[model samples]
Target: MRNSVLLLAMGMLLATGQPGLADDAELIKNTKADHEENGRWYTSDDIPTYKIAEDGTVDWPTFSGFRRYNAECFQCHGPDGAGGSYAPALATSVMNIDYYKFYETVVNGKQEVNAAQNLVMPALGENKNVMCYLDDIYSYLRARGTGDLGRGRPAKKEKKSEAFTENENACMGE
Candidate 1:
C-alpha cells in the first residue's frame, strides 16, 4: 500500500512538470543531468571554464559573467564573490547551496536579520541584465567556488557554441 501511494505521488509530480523533482531524482541516483542550452540539454562537466588560446580571446559567457558580476553583484558580494561586510561570500555559499536554491534566491531575493546584523539580497528576477545571463553568472560563480577559475580576467577562452549564441539572442529578444 505504501509503495503504491509513493508511486502515485511520483506519477502526479511527473504529470505536473515540476522542476525540482527531477533534480531530486538526479541527486538520489547520483547522476548529473545535462546542462541545457537553447532548450536542449547536453552533458559536460567542463563547459563553464575559460579556455586559453595562443592569441588570448576569451569565451563569451564566462567573460560576460565577469562583466555582469562586477556590475551587479560586486557591490554587495565583493569582487570575485569573496564576500563583503554586507554580504556573505558566494564562493563559500555556493559550495553548500544547491543550484535550485541559488536560482530561487537570486530571483526572489533573501533577507535575514538578527542582533548582530541584517543581511538582504535584492530581487533581480525581472532585471534584464541578470535574468538574461543567469546561466553565465552561475557558471562563473561555480568556477570560482570550485577553484576552477581564479581572480581577474581570464587570459583566453574557447569559442562560444552555436547553441549558446542562439539562447543568448532568444533570451535578450535580439
Candidate 2:
C-alpha cells in the first residue's frame, strides 16, 4: 500500500504542471506588450511635426524650453546646438540624450570623467516642468538643425557653393 501511494504521488507530480511556469509565460507576454507600446510611443503622429506656424505661434512650453536652453545650455551647446568643438554638440551628442535624458542630465547634472572642459551639469530639478521644456527644445532644435535626433548624430555636411556657381549668371542657367 505504501509503494502504491508513492507511485500515485509520483504520477501526480508528473501530470501536474510545475508551479510558477505560468507566471514566466505571463511575464514574457507582458514584456513583449510593453516593448510594442514603447515602439509606438515615439511615432510621428505622437510628436508634433511643426514647431511654429508661419504666423509665429510657438508651441507651448517649447518656447519656454527655448528660453531655458538659450539661457542655460547655449554657451556650451551653441546657439542651435550644432556644435562648438570646445564642447560636444547637443545636436550630435549620443550621451545623456532626449527629453527624459536631457531633463535628468540637467536636473541631476553630471560628473566630469576626464577633466575635459565638460563640467557637471547642475541639477535643475528645482525647475517646474523642465521635462516638457526639454521636449519642446528638442523638437525645435531637431526641426531647425541638420541631423537625425533619434540617431543622436548630425547629418553629414554637404559641399558648400554647390548650388550657386561663382558666376552671377548661375541662377539663369546660362
Best by TM-score: 1
- Per-residue alpha-carbon lDDT of candidate 1 for residues 1-174, written as tens digits (9 for 90 to 100): 999999999999788866676665454222122555543222354233333234755456767777788888999999998898899888777666766788899999998978977888999999988988776776667667766678887767665678887877888889
Q: Which candidate number maximizes lDDT?
A: 1
Distance (Å) between predicted and true CA of 118, model 2? 5.3
List the candidate 1 regions with Cα displacement exceeding 4 Å: 1-59
Q: Residue 56 of candidate 2: its Cα lDDT? A: 46
| lDDT minimum window of 10 residues, candidate 1 | 40-49
Clashes by residue pair, model 2: 107-123, 107-124, 109-121
Give per-residue CA lDDT, model 2, range 1-79, as digits (tens). Answer: 9999999999988788476666443432221111112111122324322233345444433344455567767777676
Q: How large is the C-alpha RMSD of every model relative to the true structure?
A: 7.3, 17.6
